[model samples]
Target: MRQHFFRCLKVKITKFIAAGMVVTCLFGSVSLGFAAPQPSPITILPIDRAKFVSGQLFDFLIEVKDADPDRIQVTVNGVTADKYFGKGAATDREASLATYRINNVAFKKPGKVEIAVKATGTAGLSTRTVKYDVVNPVAPKRAKNVILFVGDGMSLQARQMARILSQGITEGKYNDLLAMEKLSNTAIITTSGYDSLVTDSANSASAYATGHKAVVNAMGTYANSTADPFDDPNVENIVELVKRSRGMATGLVSTANITDATPAAMVAHTRKRAEQNFIAETMLDPRHRPDVILGGGSRHFLPLSTPGSKRTDNKNIIDEFKKLGYRFSGTKSELLATPPNTDKLLGLYQLDNMNVYLDREMLKNPKVLGGFDDQPTLMDMTQTAIDTLSKNPKGFFLMVEGASIDKQLHAMDWQRATYDTIELDKSIAIAKEFARKNKDTLIVVVADHAHGASITGTYHELDGKKGREAVRIYANAGWPTFADNDKDGFPDSPSPDITLAVQYANHPDYKEDYKFKAEPTVPAIMANNKAIANPQTSGEFYPGNIPSSDPSEVHSADDIILNADGPGADYFNGVMDNTEVFFGIVRALGLDGNRNVK
Candidate 1:
């Protein structure tokens, strides 16, 4: 009886073990049949595509949404910014937020900057990453001095128009040539930044100033999370590097405000270009301060108590410069009469942009700043900058920008844009003349970007029709008849018997009145956060091709022409990237002082 009972117990135990195995297999199959719920949306924009300069400062940020803060993790090339930048990150756990920012982090050697951010939540898991290439230091060839001339929005067609108007073409032949036409070296540079195909003046100029490309409206820095424009990672600019490393003098001259995008890029770094007030203040930084600064927009340097000042404080930058031994001149005569031997010069001719060349020198239009009657031309500013900078025995770097070409184009004023192009050419002429005497100077004439303006043939009032109907094209597209009999280097009248019919590839719907406006017209204005054609115009309407959000014709992703002369200029041959311009300038100056402090 005992053996029979033991046998029954063993059978019961075996049966229990078989039942447990069956239950386990069933649960495994059920789990295999179902999938996890999808995670919330997440986006990652790569910042690592650029070839970053070693030891340069940049931002490291990761964007993630719908994930719990406690579950998010960030790593830079497998390391954290806490370890890279030596700063601990703070997270908002209560708000379900996660953010990691590393400012002024330096890449010690040439390689790659790979960033990985991983997040997991109740929904699921996701990851995003970016990689950046770092390059070894390249030693530049020796050059005594460098002059960069920026023709704001001056494209090849603009150059052609200026040549036709200023030089007068006779039956396909030209009478003389533009001053920039005789450069010893030439190259076609493709201009674009990391963020977009088309770049604004600030970002494009930043690429030239710092051997690195930044986003639109940014100068010498990249966009990162933060409301403070001053907090962006700073890249050492030519103004700072040249002065600090080689003791070289630096100067910036422009027809627009000295704090304008093109000129400010040399010393300022901010994600937003509209921060002109802050940029003006940054100009006072001892690192990148210019030896000679000449331009318009004196309002920014004056105290807020001053009626026309643009500053929000009583900083009085003019007084600060004067206290620092700079000769402050506010007029053409004052700039000219100031002793050339003065080591520092600061000239501000107007509270706003200087008068256009046509108005300042020829037409004498009284509408814009007529009170400042003696404002100097771009040529005058260029000559003065050269004279002041040349006083430095250690050599100098001067950047002269004719900043109105883009401004007039934005206003849809082709004639004004043409005149500004002429002004830039004249500035180049001054530099070329100086180069003739001083072979040690490297002179470069180029545009930061291009406009979409093109010659749509000729438009003659004698065509017997009106507006677009009279626009001459194809076989009827005869050459324009712009004459310069006085040899003053400008057409006596922009509207000749035959004027070139230029059309904007991108613009708001507006009247096609083929006549140049005596006063500038605002093409579009903001209405309900959208740019609409100005309702206050008297001409027929034409629809816009670009989005209504744009108030004016937009910039094109077109290649720009770079003309160069003097030593180390040969590097600008063939088609090159925009960043290469900065390299060319640095290489010309042999700036390998390694201004980085560990």
Candidate 2:
């Protein structure tokens, strides 16, 4: 049968090879052509196979390279694009690049939609076709509230380290599992974006927020040919969907700068996550503005005249939020004093990213914390957000992030990163307690991406073995003595006699002392435009494995773990794409985005 199948539908191999045609196997019919198909020069936004909730707004764009200025046609399904969108395209052309863009459009119905683009270029006619899926989740029992926890750079190892520190193991058995680990449903989540193998916090978080993949350094939008960051094709995120569809309150809480990549992705749409100043201003846009905002980036919200302000323009965003009836808080005391009736709250504790839990709370080092010592814990911030957002009968969607896990890992400070992971774990416990009282709440805990840190074994200088020699492996490795003496979940001391010997798989040239830094120090320093081991450690030097341009470790492409509880979490099972998280949240809330958009 196989011989007969190939013999009956055979192509002239010589003739097809003479042309640039590609031959098909027995399963496909052969097509003889002048050339094998080439990739289209025109690019469409939303990418191919994008999924969305019906009526979720997004910007559509067609970018053409080396094309004639006036020769471009776009169609949606079979209808002309402009007519289909009920508006004409805003065309822009510069040099060899031209674009046809339509902003703030949505599919009113649930089904598949095709976008076809054709442009006349010097290389002749260039055509492209892309399809999208629109869905409307009809739930049996809806969750009135949803809380997402992102532990940035928290890989499986990162989580395990937190577990070991917070809940010690005895004879190869853990005494207690983490609060997140106790979740009913869990999944191994793939964390790459469309453009890169390894993703940064912004791109991964954007996938979680918008149900669409974005490139590194970008969030809430797709990249376009133009250089403008804000003008990129925008996608409606979870924040916007919950707002217009269900009148749900929204909150974004983080330990990093409030306008940083992970937190900002929930609300801001930009091709560059570094646009912190603009992100701070975009929060004022009522169409998708969050009801509660908490974090450590007061600099971006302050006016340019303020000494530590990061904005170039003299825009006082904090004052603007005040005008909009938001009670402002700059310290833990102020946050705690916020009126219980205050539904709108804005808290920015530090001028920059907040210090890690270790440095801020336990170490009490004035040098590390500077003057901003009154910062709130992740648990307190999340509790405050839940309290304020729940005031709305419609419920809310809140995103809480442990921002320093990634930052400390980048600096190769495993001790600090592990403490932040514990902090995130404790915060998850708080959210779980809230969900217990309100059965209509869903809680999700996940990592934006993984770091390259790994545990070789335990390290100790007890036997006079020092540096690399002190690293114990196999039978010599004993359990780390990380005791939670006071029952606060955190180890009494991070520098136990036997401590985790965490090493980086991908790292810059750096010093290795087999000891935690008393104060956080850069693993590498720039010397003559190249990274070199820091001299502060006074230990053996290890050469960098990655490019010299990066003095810190980079994100790993490894799959991350996600745990969830309450309604609709069962949707997450087996191996899943990162974008599915957004769908899971929407499904749990029964958010119906199918509506008219004007």
Candidate 3:
């Protein structure tokens, strides 16, 4: 009876072990059966599953929630990260959040690299793996100089509108192509950043300045957990790289404020682009500052004691730059009068953004100019920048921006935007002329983003059918009657009898007047935190399809065109990410970021 009872007990024990194995096979692991829910997955910067250029510097960061630093293990390609990088990461703890940072790390060779992190604590065990492709590029014959022209929001439609209005069309065929259209090489550039489908100027320009994608409103820096804009992890921009590695002269010229996104991305390292005052001060840093800085935003350069100052502090940046031997110009006349031999220049034509071509030069509207009427044209600024930057025996990198194209388009003023596009083309002509002479200057013309505007048909008031009713489409849509009788690149008058019916693909609740305002005007105004049609115009009211939070038309995710000429221009062919612009420029300049300079 005792032997039989022992035999039954052994069989029961064996069955129990078999049942446990079945449960382990059904579930993930034996430990997981008794363990609590896994901890939240780790977050890493430079992200996982992305491609990086070999020798490009970026910050390595990791965040694990509710995990002890001692319990975390990070490895790169099965080896400890500290051993792979030859340096350990710095750790910081705040309550349940633990942060690990390894700054300015780069992959020297080309290959696939995997970063794995495992964290174990009371919560549970969590793991994450990030993969990166480090690319090795071949050296090319370098160009002596590179000129990048950003026609802010200059879309294909914008280009066509400029071509029609400036060059005129007769019998559906005609005169000539714009300078940008005549470039030797072209590419379709995708402008989306890592954070979103559509990108702002700051992040878009950041891609070209630094060969890394950034979040919107951020430039040359990765957005961090801190509230301080300047405290983010920085990726060295083209200005810094060129200056530090090659001792190249740099110039930034724009119709917008010098502290604005496009130009500021070339130097400033901040997560927030709207930090105008801080950006103004950062422009004085000798490490990355440009040799020629021309545009507006004098308000930020003035001290708090000054009448039109925008800065909160008593620091007078204009005075500081003057002390550093910068020749400052405050007007068109002053800019022209600046000596040709002046090595350094700081020109601020207005307290805010310099007026657009239509308002400042063509119309000369006092209301829009606001006592600052003598702003120089974008062409003037570009020519001046080129002249000053060329004085250096070493080659220079100049970024010229036609900023008001985006600004006017946001206001739903297509005519003004088209004029600015023409202005950009003229500036491109200037750069092409310079490139022709130098033979070694690489000139790239591209847009940061695209507006939601397109040319649908033609509008005519001859029949007296007003607004939307007068919009003639298809076979009925005749050619526009824009004329350039004076031989100037601009149309004689913006408001012709038969003009192009430009429409916005996306807009706020606004009136569609289908006519150009004599002065600059906003399409929608804020009321009760919502966008409402401006009562200033009379037309058919259309409700917005976009969110009410937006006061104007927003940028589109559509790809923009990039045109290039001169040496190394062949690299710009087929589709490319905006970050590739930086690589192209680097290849043209043969920049060695690891090189040391005095």
Scored by TM-score, the top model is: 2
> Over 4 Å off in model 2, which ranges?
1-37, 596-598
> What 10-residue stretch in candidate 2 is worst by lDDT?
24-33
lDDT of 1 at 82: 78
Query: Tens-digit lDDT track for model 1 on 1-598?
Result: 5565566556554665444322112322211123334543443332556655555555554545657766768777787757866776654432444554555556767787776778876557877666777665443446789999999888888888888888877766987778888898999988898789999999999989987878899998766545788766667678877886778999999999999899999889898988888888888888889988999989999899998998899999888888989998888888878786887888999898887887787777677656888888888888888888888888999999989888888888889888888888888988888888988889888899998888888888784777787789998877888877887788888778789898888897666777777667778888998887788766568889988888888788788899998878888899988888887887777664445322
TM-score result, candidate 1: 0.83
TM-score attained by model 2: 0.94
Comparing candidate 1 with candidate 2, which one achieves the higher lDDT?
2
C-alpha TM-score for every candidate? 0.83, 0.94, 0.91
lDDT, candidate 3, 83-200, per-residue tens: 8888888888677778788888877777899999998756699888889887654336678789999999998889999999988887889578898999999999999988899999
| Candidate no. 3 TM-score | 0.91
lDDT of 1: 0.79
lDDT of 2: 0.90
